[model samples]
Target: MNTTRKLLVLASMTSLVTGCTSLPPDAGFDEVSVNVEQRIANKVHWYTGGEEDAQVRQSIHDRLAQPLTADSAVQIALLNNYNLQAAYADLGISQADLVQAGLLKNPVLEMTRLKPRNGEDASLDIELRFEFLDILLIPLRKKVATQQFAAAKQRVTATVLDHAALVRKAFYEAQTSQHMEDMFREVTSSTEAALEAARRLRKIGNITAGTFDRFQLSHDETRLSLAQSEMSNRASREKLNQLMGLWGEQTQWLIEGGLKPIPFKPIDVNDIEKRAIANSLDLAILKHDIEALAERSGIENVKSIIDDLEAGYAWDRESSGEWSDGPTIELRIPIFDFGHARRARVAAELKQLQDSYYARAIEIRSSARALSDRLQSSRAMVEHYIDNILPLNRRIKDNELLNYNAMQIDVFKLLRAHEKQVASRQLFVQALRDYWLARADLETLLSGRANTVSDMRGPAISMGGGNEGGH
Candidate 1:
């Protein structure tokens, strides 16, 4: 192209791009704004209150971390998180769309007048018309919008539940870190005592330098392990706070301990199955999607079809084109544009809905099966660690303590037993964490109520039933 033409073309392109103005970030979802107030209101609860007292902060933290029969973290997330707030706005936008879809198009108005040149007066012509689709398609459009809003609500519920599950997982992880730290500290203390006893024994020519060096190494390693555990705990806390929507340096929380033991109760699988099938957010969302697809199918039925039902009144004016007394009507037929495309679209939508429904069913089944298997395995592991390994290690530690007090064995044996006990306790904690995590996963997968691994007490309970003996 010539330089001038090229310049003109470039300018034209620029104008076209600029003239096609970008919508505001929220322009598309304005209806969501209206629903925000109600969703936000739904989150109000006593548990949503903010912490104030410095001394009681740790206790408050413990309470929040305390395991409940049902997960409250989801409720907290809905009440607190900024991202969820945005989701509420989305719901409002969808609601507004439904309202808009129900409305009809405004009729167009036109007026024309002519003036006589030589001797007479002026006359006027008027006409009014509107798109027929506005009258015919608005009800179908409204149905689609309503379905969309319902789907949005389902999504919001699902998001909150997911957040709650995450909070529980993070809480358990941080607690595990704390437990590991405590175990390492106990190990370090015992090792330190052993090292001191070894030094005295070396002075008396009872123990060798090599043994003392080994004790020193164990002590140092314990310290290193403790430090690493602390770092992990801090990171876990940060993750939990992030999910809770606390930002910046203020995100710090006072996590006291791992989950407190709760009374164990084996959930009735049948009840869970029923509840999940009825209340599961994913299922509800899928159902809403199916409804939406059905609505679209109806619209699709009209898509390839074009109907021309145009009507206009022409006034027969008097001399000089003044207002007329009567009117004449005209109609246009839909000739080339038939409803074939619309029929195809409807067929496609029906197939899409069918496919989605089957896919969702498969997903639900797979998720439930995986979760059940994991929960069973984890519960068995926890039982083995707590019932068999933990008590055996504790007895060994007690025996070693007795030997040391009697001067039958040196402090080194005592330290070794202490380390063993700490290791066993750490393993037990891990088992418990796994059990709880598995339960949480299973609950989410089945859309069932969150089953607590611990009650209000800070000890592990047998999953089968409470033993009639003391711990």
Candidate 2:
């Protein structure tokens, strides 16, 4: 081919590669949002320091204007949580990288001037060189970068859903703590009234000093329990506030409902595990990582043999005013560093990803099964407390009251029966809390990294009759 024809062909090829590698206007944000919405079914914002800031602020204000429900709390977090916003920012960074990968490196420009010793005319040389090999690798790099961007989207979506799940669990915990605190307050009030009655009886010689002492001790214990419950309520509220990204006045928001018994529903354990493996963001990211690494390995294999190549056109005018134009080429001789280390590193990385994929799959399956069992067991326990235990305790308290009215039981006995009934109700509350917490854990297991379950288990309440040895 003629020199002009070769130059024209090279120019056309470069233009073709550049044109094929351009990014879209939105840089894939819309698609990321769509994927997030599909998983969370909630609105997500990618703040760009634009007009959307006002919109997100307004949305947060509107959601927080009412008592915070679980869904509303999640929405607020998605709009306001700093961590989730940071994850969204990663999407922008990945897209920028994708764009950068598609872009061609600017050609190197050099100019030289020389003057001959024999009073000859000055001559100049100019050379423009491009990494033509990089042009050849443009499509491959772009493909790897595109996969990276895709993984970024998945990561952002997973983070949003994870935050949503966290908000849910925190909301449930705060509500449970608040309800338990209120229950303890009621128990304390009942104990105080009983203690006052016992004091009057003891002063009138109708009850023994020991009986009054028992009432006093129970009242003090109830007060202590109430204080602890109050502390727990405060801590749980603060945690929920933090998860919702609330501060100052926003932290004072109310929860709409307390923990309640979850209705029993059988879940298909196998289906859950299947979905977890298929939809897990960790697994997805790893899969993308493997793909990117495979592409990188391909590049590395090429580099292992021929490290570098550069080719372009150069023009020169000699001291005699003789002009020359021709193609130029440069190559890096691979004599010492042969890229074996790079190939081994990539091989190790690929193996690690493959193992991680399987490991994550196994973890998801185990967690799914465990969570399903826990949910079922917790639901059953809550129902047992609500249906069988609380009513029986109430009946025992009613019978003790009747016995007191008929002069068959002492005031101490009646008071102790009431306390037992209250204790049973507290147990019922704890069961409800456990059910809700387990439900939240199940969500976390499915959604990838949300709020974790508390390690503390509820105190086991025996189902026997009321205390009969009261003084």
Candidate 3:
């Protein structure tokens, strides 16, 4: 065959091979979304620039217009958070790599002119070269790329779920801060009333100067606590706003309710470790990494045997109009470096990935167990505060008020009782916050991400006792 016909045939074969192995248009996004939906009960959208549907943004805006619930907060974050959107873009990058792997490298064209010393016309020689070895290795390369893309999809999905969990935690935290701020304001009002009564009684010589000073100190302390709680409230609200991808007017959104109550029945923790192992996305990604490495090791073994091979067609035309055409071959002699180092490196990577997979599995199980225990403990504490401690403190406050009304105790004593009651209620709010935060952590574990439990500590509740001795 002529050199031109031979090159054309080679190009045809290359096209056929690439066409057979090309990935689907969606590139596994639908599959990844299905898995994420099963775990989070929320679907994810990949925004391709202007291609994002208007309805999605509209839905988010409508949800924001209403008082935000925890589930709605998660939905808005999944749909609109810029960080999660960036994570989705990473999937596109991996898809591009996968597509590039399946494609054949472009043919190289070279031309040379030779002029004789006799001053005759110059002869032109032309060559077209194709890296046929890459064609031979395309299948293996595509397999590795496919696995890597799958791992990328899992990583992106895990990130989305992680963000959703964060939004939930922030939502509850913001709600808790709002409730605390309101509680502290009430306490402040009560302190002001007690201080006013003490001043009046002292002005008329009915109460000691020491007692009036105690009431003034308590009022000052209550005001300081109220200010701190207000700051905390604002900070928590801003954090939630950021998580929800809100700014400007969006920050004015309201929460539907305070921190949710603990469930009546404790969650079943049986075989949680086993379940976590089965569902862990991080472990799945590591397994894919190992698979890709194994495929790479195979390719390296092929290269170790024969390093480089190129085949093409060459043509030459002389001054007299004579033409020549023939096949050309280029090979690299493996004298010193025969891909041995590459093979060894791939082997080391495979081992590392395998070990990492096993280590991650162990970590997931351990984390599942620890988080399960914490969830149970947190639930018990929340229930204890709600069912016993808070009601008892309220009863104590009621009895103190009755005693004071009957002139059995001074105003300072009654105010102290109220302050203790508020302190107990504040503790109860903190326990509720802890319960919700633990629940968020548990969800993250169950969704196959290795997120550590957030710190459950909150602002301290002053007992208002330092100045009580002045009475």
Candidate 4:
């Protein structure tokens, strides 16, 4: 075949190869959305500023019209959060790289014209050059880019999952804070009434000044605590709003649920470490890195001596219309850079990735075990309050009421028991919050999405005598 015909044939083959990987309209978000939906029942959308943007906005608006639940809150964030939408850009960028890798460089065309001094004769030369070596390397290049793109998808998917977990955590925190504020408000009211009664007693010289002062101080402190609870609730609610990408009227939305008790049940976590390592996207990404590097190392080793190669066709035509055509070849001789450094770098990276993957596996296993323990401890703490501490406080309050009715105890003792009972309930609320947080973290980890360690030690509920804790 003539050089021109051969080049045309090669071009035809290249075009045929590039058609295999055309991306869908949403890039790769369908897979991510499906994965998230399967795992958590959360729906995700990539807002394209098209008709779907209005749909998602309407969806979020509808969900926000009522009181928010944790799952709905996460779904809204996945659809509406600007940050999550921004994160979807990585998929687009990576998919572009993958598509680019599967194609050959464009052919370079050059034209040259010459005229004699007599101006009677002219020479025309035309040449076309392309990186013919690229055709051979396209598969390897695509292989590497494919793995890297897969890694990018995994990482971005992990980001979405982690975001969902944070939304859940923030939702529970806001819920607990809301309930805490209400409880403190009630406590303050009780304290105020008791202080007023004590004031009447002091006026009648029935109680000492010290006793009246204590009652007055308790009421003042309780009011101050109510103020603190209000601010805390505000802050937690605002954080949840930020995660859900809400502003304006959406910020005024209410969380529906209180700190409902999570059932205390035995969860088999003995295999959780193995499952975590298996599911962890972090390790999966490293595996892709290792695969791409290994493939790259083999390619570089095979082509170490050939730094650059190009071949094409050249044609020359004299002014008499006589034409000549031939194949042209160009090669770059490797004198100083034999790709030794490049090969060594790839090799080193491959080794580093291997070792790092091993280390990360260990870390994931440890984190899984730690999170499992935290989940169990949180569950135990919640159950302890429900089964022991709160019940005991209620019983003590009952005994105090009986003693007061029988004239065996003073009002001060009865009030003290009542305060302790309220503190236990407040503490129980925080314990439930911690239990939910730990559950979110563990589930995210086991699903191979997130690797974060939550604040297993829950927020303290402070009252007069002691602060409540879940640890």
Query: What tens-digit string does per-residue lDDT give for candidate 3 at 1-471?
Result: 266777688768756765744446666678778988999899777676554658788888899899999999999888888898777777777887777776666677899999877988889898988776777777777787788888888888778777888899888888899999988998999899999998889899998989788889989998999999999989998898888889888778888876777877777788989888888888877777777778867778877877678888888989766888888999888899988787777777677767777877888888988888888888888888878998898898899899999999987788888889988988888988888888788778888777653211111111111111100
Per-residue lDDT tens digits for candidate 1, residues 91-136, read 5566655555655444445667777787677666655544554446
Indicate whether candidate 2 or candidate 3 has the larger lDDT.
3
Against the reference, the lDDT scores of all candidates come to 0.59, 0.75, 0.79, 0.79
Off by over 4 Å in 3: 1-7, 20-27, 49-52, 453-471
- Return whichever of 1 and 2 wins on lDDT: 2
Each prediction's TM-score versus the true structure: 0.73, 0.87, 0.91, 0.88
| TM-score, cand. 4 | 0.88
The regions of model 4 sitting more than 4 angstroms off are 1-22, 49-55, 117-120, 207-211, 318-322, 453-471
Which lDDT value does model 2 have at 77?
A: 82
Tell me the spans in candidate 2 whose CA falls farther than 4 Å from its real position. Answer: 1-16, 20-25, 49-56, 116-119, 206-211, 267-270, 447-471
If the candidates were sorted by their TM-score against the true structure, best first, what order would they fall in?
Answer: 3, 4, 2, 1
Encode model 2's per-residue lDDT on 383-422: one tens digit a residue: 7887889889989999999999999987778877887887
lDDT of 4 by residue, 96-153 (tens): 7777776666667899999977876799898887776676677777787777778778
What local lDDT does model 3 show for residue 454?
27
